[model samples]
Target: MKLALFLVLLTLSMSTRAVLDDCTCLVDCKCKKSLRPGQYYCASPDVDTDSQAIRNCNRDTGTVEVPCYAAPNVSCGGLPYNATQCIFTESRPCTFVNGKRYNYYLAVGLSLFLGMLGVDRFYLGYPAIGLMKLCTMGFFLIGHLLDFLLILLQVVGPADQTGYYAPFYGPLVSRVLVNGTDPFIESSSSCTL
Candidate 1:
C-alpha cells in the first residue's frame, strides 16, 4: 500500500514538470516587432466595421472591384470611340453565282467548224438534224454554207441586224478567227445570259 501511494505521487510530479517544446506562437502575438500598425488581429474580441473591412478585403487575391458608375468618356482599348457595345458579326451564306452562262459563244463557234460533218449539231443536242446534215454532206454543202452564214449573222450580224447579236459578240468573233475546239461540247448545256 505504501509503494502504490509512492508510484502515484512520482507519476503526478513527472507530469507536472513536463516541458512543452512543440508549442507554437500565435501570428498576431504582441511579441513580434514586424507586425503592421493596422494588421488583422484574429484573436481580438472587438468585432466592428474596420475588422469587418479586413475580413472583406481581397487585395492580394486576383479579384477586381468593378466600379458601379459607368464612365461616358471611357472607351474599349482598340475599338472605335463611337461604338457603344461590342457585338460578334458572322458572314451570311453566299446566294448568287456570277456568269453562269459564259459558254454560249463557244457552242456557236463549234457549230461553224464541224457543221459539215454534223459533229457540231450532235454535240448541240440536235442529233436528228446532225444526222441529216451528215447524210447530205451538210445539205450538199449548201446547209453547211447556210449554217456558217447563220453563225456569222449571229456574230457580227448583217451590219443592220444590230439587236440580234449578244454583248459577248467580241469573244465569238475572236474564237472564230482562232477556230479551236468547241469549248461547250463537254458541258451539259450552253451558258446563256
Candidate 2:
C-alpha cells in the first residue's frame, strides 16, 4: 500500500510539472528565440532587443516570467512598471535607515504594550518625547494613544528621517503615483475640465 501511494504521488507531481512547463503569454506578444536552447522572450513586435519590455521564458521548463527593466539606478516608484515607458521595472526592497534598522513589528509591539512607559519612544530614538512620556506617564494616557496610532499608521519613523525596517511577511504599502495617474480610478476615459 505504501509503494502504491508513492507511485500515485509521483505521478501527480510529474503531471503538475508538465502543466507548468506549458505556460504561455496571454498578451498579443511573439516569441523571440534566445541563444540558450528552449529559452526565449515574449515581447511586442514593435519592441527592439534594446527595449526593456521583454519577458524571459523557458519553453522546456515552462516558467512564466515577469518583465522588468534592467537599467541601473532607475527608480520604479515601487511599482512593477516604469512610469515613463510603462514597461516593467524592478528595484531592491530597502529596510535600512541611516545605516541602521529597526523592526516594524517590534516597534508596533513596544508601542502596544509599553507605550505608557515611553519605552516605544526610546526605542525609536526620540529621547525628548520619551522623557516627557516617562515623566507624565504618557501625557495622562492621551499621548500614549496618539503615539500608538501614529506608529500603527507608520507616520512616525526613525529619528534620522528615514523609514523603519520592513516586516518579513506582511503587506507593504507604498504611496507612489504611477504616470501621475490616480490608482483609485478603474478607467481613464473620463474627461477633465
By lDDT, who's the top model here? Answer: 2
| Index of the highest-TM-score prediction | 2
Clashing pairs in 2: 21-62
**Backbone clash count, each prediction separately:** 1, 1
- What residue runs in model 2 are displaced by over 4 Å at the alpha carbon? 1-98, 176-193
Residue-level lDDT of model 1, residues 27-99, one tens digit each, is 2212223323221111211112321211222223311121111122322333232221211111111111122
**What CA RMSD would you report for each candidate?**
38.4, 15.8
Per-residue lDDT, model 2, residue 190, is 23
Residue 45 Cα positional deviation in candidate 2, in Å, after optimal superposition: 26
Clashing pairs in 1: 101-191
TM-scores for all candidates: the values are 0.28, 0.44
Quote the lDDT for 58 in model 2.
27
Q: What is the C-alpha local distance difference test score of candidate 1? A: 0.38
